[model samples]
Target: MGSLFEELEAREATARKRVEALEAEVAEVSGRLSAAREGLERLRIARETVAEVLAEMTPEKPGVAVDTDRSSAVDSVASAYAGAERHVIGVLTVPNWQPGMGAEVLPRVYRDILEVVTDARGPVRAKQIVPRIGLPAEAGKIEGTRSKLKRLVERGWLDEDTPGMFTPARRRGGASPNSR
Candidate 1:
């Protein structure tokens, strides 16, 4: 009787493990289903976008000519937007700064780095900035600074004129560290 009871207990434990595994599988299937639903939504959006674009380009009436004026207007708007974007230094607002303090939102090292680069009248290299920013001559520090500068360019805080050369991005109203 004792041996029989032990066998039943072991079987129960095994059953429990099997049930847990099945539950895990169910959860995985649920996640996959969710992802499939999201993909379907994206497909729907894409289809709608293509339909809208086709409608715009196609003539609504059988004999109507494609609207040249509408096409020209679109072109004008695109060029104007591009010109405006190119003229502005960065997309972000230029926060007011106390000459030496830099922007409050930036890290101390970043402010130091920006100050050095902007103080240079023209585009400066990462090598040039490292010393002025007081970073050590180690290769790691130099590379790190270079990466930071690149990121700054991406964030619209700085501009890259040449490979590895950086300059201050102009503010929306033409104000910048140099202008100030």
Candidate 2:
């Protein structure tokens, strides 16, 4: 009877030791998981910041580099965010036209507007362009088209000779074909 009691005590001691070991392992694994999550979060933030900076960049000079100030800032930011996972989101905006650049860079709607203006026999009105671009002939649509036309003109992608009249911008050597 004494031997049976001693055996029960020994088994209880072994079970307690096993439970303690498992608890320590669980704590260690939880700490590792928390560190991994923090690292992943840092990486995500870095990737988003980089995407924004890249989206804001403009193709200024052909062979020459531009925006040295911005470039340096990007470099510092990139180094700080190194080892992050790759996930990117960007916003597209109308870019100021540069020589040797093509219309491909423009967003779809802007390209459509340019195409309509370019195909027109002469200067076109926003109202005329609105329907041609497949928009309803409504006041709101016309106004929106006009705003885009003005933006194109401001970006040097189009020329506005008269009020509410839009045409393709003239080249350096000669006037736009529609201008004549």
Candidate 3:
């Protein structure tokens, strides 16, 4: 009976030591998990702070004035279509006129006209472009808008499906023919 009692005491001691070691391991793992979670939370907060700061800052201005001019041309064309009593049948082709000479003389007007034309459903004729693109009424006398459309077609901005009918080149994935 005395030996049996001693054996029971030794077994209890062994069990207690194992339980203590397991408890220590559990505590170490729990500490590591908590530290990792805190690090993740800090990173999330940093990202949100950066986003908020950027939102508070003023947006970057356009690099070139020519881009604004092209945008204005697009606006003018849209406005013209909006006010027209006639259903918009086609796009307008503005003359290749730049305000100044030099490297600034990019044919942006053709691209702008193509953008507006492609936004429409039907073919756009040259006569329709004069008033819409902010061109002078006298533009009608300058070999007519037909010649301007032909010029655009030659540049690949406008496609002449027939003699007088014109359409914009098909665009895909936010890219246009002249975007590159």
Candidate 4:
């Protein structure tokens, strides 16, 4: 009986030591995982910044060859692109609506925009359009949406009744020029 009791005590001591070692390992791994998550978050923010900068950069005469010493021109273009990128990032982080995507989500941005503009008897401004579309009243968001509205007008989907005001193109009694 004395020998058996001693064997059980030795086994309990080994088990306790294993539990302590596992606790130490768990702490180390948790610290590493936390550091990795922070690094990943930093990388994600960097990626978004690069994407915004790229979005604002445009090739001057995309496929055309430069015929002169364009150092000054290149500098100007870079500066302009940087300014545009900052402006866009400061205000709106949203992308413009793509008309080709079929209805898939509830209260779509493009459809809501049309509904807001058409529901009014006349031209609509960004002030009126912003809330209807469910975006925050940020300067960048408002201006970005306004810009999108202008493009839709150029594409024959809507008409600009006046500067910064919008109306549906169909009110003029014709199909969109680009529509099939």
In terms of TM-score, which candidate is strongest? 2
Model 1 agreement with the true structure over 40-151: per-residue lDDT tens digits: 9788757544433332333443322223354553444344356544332222222233234345566576778888887898998888788888766768668868876775
The lDDT values for all models are: 0.63, 0.71, 0.53, 0.61
Best by lDDT: 2
The C-alpha stretches of model 4 lying farther than 4 A from their native spots are 1-107, 171-180
- In candidate 1 the C-alpha lDDT for residue 117 amounts to 80
**Total clashes in model 4, counting residue pairs 3 or more apart in sequence or in different chains:** 0
Q: Estimate the overall C-alpha local distance difference test score of candidate 3.
A: 0.53
Residue 143, candidate 4: C-alpha displacement in angstroms:
0.5
Q: Write the per-residue lDDT of candidate 2 for residues 1-180, one digit (tens) a residue.
A: 999999999999999999999999999999999999989978875754454355444546221122335455445445545775632222324556665778998878889999999999999999999888898898866886887787688767899889888888986654333222
User: Could you tell me which 10 consecutive residues in candidate 2 have the lowest summed lDDT?
Assistant: 61-70
Q: Give lDDT for model 1.
A: 0.63
Native-referenced Cα lDDT, model 2: 0.71
**Ranking of models by lDDT:** 2, 1, 4, 3
